[model samples]
Target: MRIRAVGTSALMIEVEDPLAWFAALDAARTDGRIDVTDIVPGARTVLLDGVPSVAALTAALRDWPPPAAASVTGDRLDIPVIFDGPDLAQVAAHVGRSPEGVVADLTGTAFRVAFGGFAPGFAYLTGLPWSIPRLESPRPRVPAGSVALAAEYAGIYPTASPGGWQLVGRTDAVLFDIDRTPPALLTPGRTVRFVIA
Candidate 1:
């Protein structure tokens, strides 16, 4: 738990794991009186953006201790997915499981927002059992809402873009919409449970 001055109007909180950092940042949001514009969680740091000034923000964070953050509220979205991806067979073969089994295993689990990167609203969901191999090659164009898996994480393509993850299914969850207030279905530390429907 370290705070660094970010010019003016910003503070950066560094932590070992970004997911853990998210927990702390959300806590600060509830406990402090600072207006945060953005909280960008890195692998080992959290960038707290949009503040009044550096000196004031630094002083404000001094009172903050890394404690358990309140559970972030995430919309329980039901996305109907069609489990049809080219990598379906490959992923199952790597794990010595059938493709149907892979789908079943994937759908039954819930995930959290480890961080947000790779693409807008794309939660770098960790805790995907932690034994899967990282993607060898990224696809040129992964369709929007594509369900994918990688080492220790599973993700959904918020929008159609290039990505490097094992595709399993496609969801219709509107992860990002400009009209929406936050414009994302997943937020830091928010639980995400997937269903086969």
Candidate 2:
């Protein structure tokens, strides 16, 4: 792990495993060990925003023990999905399985929100058994609530937008709502499971 200063008040910690670091940093902030305003997670980094003293945090981090393995300790949400997408058969073919088999495998896996990007409330989920490639040509628009997969991540489209991920299903769950206290439903560390609608 490497901690580097980002501007005046933020420190970006680059790690091989962002989830573990994120959980550790979040716990530190909650327990009053770190007076940080925000902990933003990325593909392989955790950005500590609004720190009062970067030097103090950096020194403390050096003395801290190695972070524990990250666990899905956040809210667990079961999303009801209709496993009938245009690319369902294609995904099955890529995995060398029937559509039903693919659905079974997906529903059986426990996914965790790694980070949020691409759009509001759109989370890049982790826990796929293997990596999958994106579509050669991205669709002009993917409807909201579309459950899709790309690379090593699974995600849901929070709004109708152009995307390249392979769509495998659709859901009715509200991923984002401005009125909601926590606008995004799949914040980092949350657990998600897809169930047949």
Candidate 3:
């Protein structure tokens, strides 16, 4: 792990495993070991905002033991999905499974929210056993609520927009709402599951 200053306040910690580090940092904050206002996690980094003293925090973090591999320590959400998509057969073929089998596998596995990007409320979920490839050509627009897979991540389109993922299903659950307190449904580190609708 490496900590770098990110202006007058805030420290960006680069780590091999972000979720584990995130859990550790959150614990520090909760236990009063660190004073910070926000803990923002990314794919490979965790940003500590509102730091009182960067120097002090840096020294403290260095002396602290490295975080262990994290289990799913966040809130769990079950999303109801309809497993019927244009690329469902393609995904099955790629994995050498029937469509029903594909759905079974997807629902059976628990996914973790690795990060949020590409669109508002669109979370890059990790935990697939196999990495799936992106479509060669980007689609003009993927419908809102489309559950798609790309690389090792599974994501839902919060709003209709152009996308390049392999669509495998969709959900009616609202992924983002400006009126909601936190907005994004799938914040980093949250455990997610897809259930047949």
Candidate 4:
């Protein structure tokens, strides 16, 4: 693991495996060892914001053991989706599979929330191995609950927004709500599953 300064009160911790690092951070937070205001995870980095001191954070992490393989110990959310997106056929053709085959492939695998970005409540989920390219021309606006894939990650649009991911389905799950204690339904390290409705 490598630690670097981020502006004034933030530290960026880069690790070979970000999920493991995030797991370790979660454990530390549960044990009341991490006092940072926010912990944001990326593909392979964790940004610790509002840190009291870099030394303190480093000291805690130094004694923390590396996390085991990706495990879904927390809540596993099941999202029911209807496979009727405009790009469903195109995605199936691009992947050399029928629409049913494409849906089967997606539902067969378990996904984990790797990180949240692009928008609020928008989680970048990992586990799907097949590569799906982004649209050459992005849509002016994609509706909320749109299930889409880009590169190697699958995502659900929390709200209507302009996007380029190839949509394969849509769900009715409320991914973000201001009144909720946690505004975003998906967080790093959470387990997720997509199912046909």
Candidate 5:
């Protein structure tokens, strides 16, 4: 792990394993070792905001170890989805499987939220045993609640926007709500299951 200064009050810790880095930070926070306002985790780094100084944070992290288990145990969310996406057949063909087979593969496996990016409430899920390719040409607009997959990640479109991920289904679950205490339904460390509707 490598720690670097980010501006005056933030420190960015670069790690080879982001999940482990997040777990360590979470452990530190739970143990009252961290004195920061926010921790933003990316695919490869974590940003600590509102820290007093990089030196202090670095010293604190020097003795911190990544937790053997995940510190954040989020609620399990089961989402019901209708297999009626425009790219469903295309995805199936690309994977050398029938549509039913593709759906079976998706529903048979459980996924975990690794991180959030691209859009608010857009969680890049991990644990997909198989990989899928992105579209050669991205769609101009993907409808809200679209369940899509690209590479090794699965995601739900929090809101309508342009996207390149292959859509395989649609879910009614609200991924984000401004009025909610935590706007994003799929937070990091949360486990997700997709049920065929």
Candidate 6:
């Protein structure tokens, strides 16, 4: 991976692996010298957008050895969820496991807030069990605090917005509220762990 200057608008850190980019982002964000307003992390590249001189930031990133897997160790966010999703039975059938097993996998393991872009406060995570079912369609109004799953990840809907992720459960936590500072509770690169009560 190479950290190159991509004009004054942003500094592009070109990374080959998705995980490496996150590790680099985790490192750069810790250093206070470079003010990063936007850390757009992707599968290969992590883009930083800000007004500071790109030359200075680029230099700061150069020779920055990506951290080890353990260093990038994500956070655990315990999100309490219910197993009353409409697709609960179907998901269990798809994975050849009991509905209780599906519920356990979704809330028992640790996941990370890989990115936040699908919507305001909408977190995109990874490291979900692969034996889950795919979302067939979206619901017009998935109540707030709904814990949904799709593909290989799961997330909580910050608002009562239309979504496609398989309905899994709901949490009482406020993921995104404009009243709070910056309004967003989750940011990319942070870890998450779900704890069902």
* Per-model CA lDDT versus the true structure: 0.75, 0.92, 0.91, 0.87, 0.85, 0.72
- Candidate 5 residue pairs that clash: none
lDDT of 5 by residue, 83-183 (tens): 99899899888889999998998888778888898988999988876789999999999999999999999999999999999999999999988889789
List ranges where model 3 is wrong by over 4 Å.
none
Off by over 4 Å in 4: 59-65
Candidate 5's C-alpha runs over 4 A off are 69-72
Q: Among all windows of ten consecutive residues in candidate 3, which has the lowest summed lDDT?
A: 66-75
Worst 10-residue stretch by lDDT in candidate 1?
69-78
* Best-performing candidate as measured by TM-score: 2
Specify the poorest-scoring 10-residue window by lDDT in model 4.
64-73
Off by over 4 Å in 1: 17-24, 27-32, 59-63, 69-72
Candidate 2's TM-score reads 0.95
Per-residue accuracy of model 1 over 114-166 as CA lDDT, tens digit each: 67777778887755753567577778899998988887788899989988888
Sorted on lDDT, best first, the list reads 2, 3, 4, 5, 1, 6
Model 2 RMSD in Å is: 1.2
The TM-score values for the models, in the order shown, are: 0.82, 0.95, 0.91, 0.92, 0.92, 0.78
| Weakest lDDT window of 10 consecutive positions for candidate 5 | 64-73
lDDT of candidate 6 vs native? 0.72
Candidate 3 lDDT, tens digit per residue, 51-136? Answer: 99999998988887778987686579999999999999999999999999999999998999988878889999998867899999
Ranking by TM-score: 2, 5, 4, 3, 1, 6
For lDDT, the strongest prediction is 2
Clash pairs, candidate 1, are 9-51
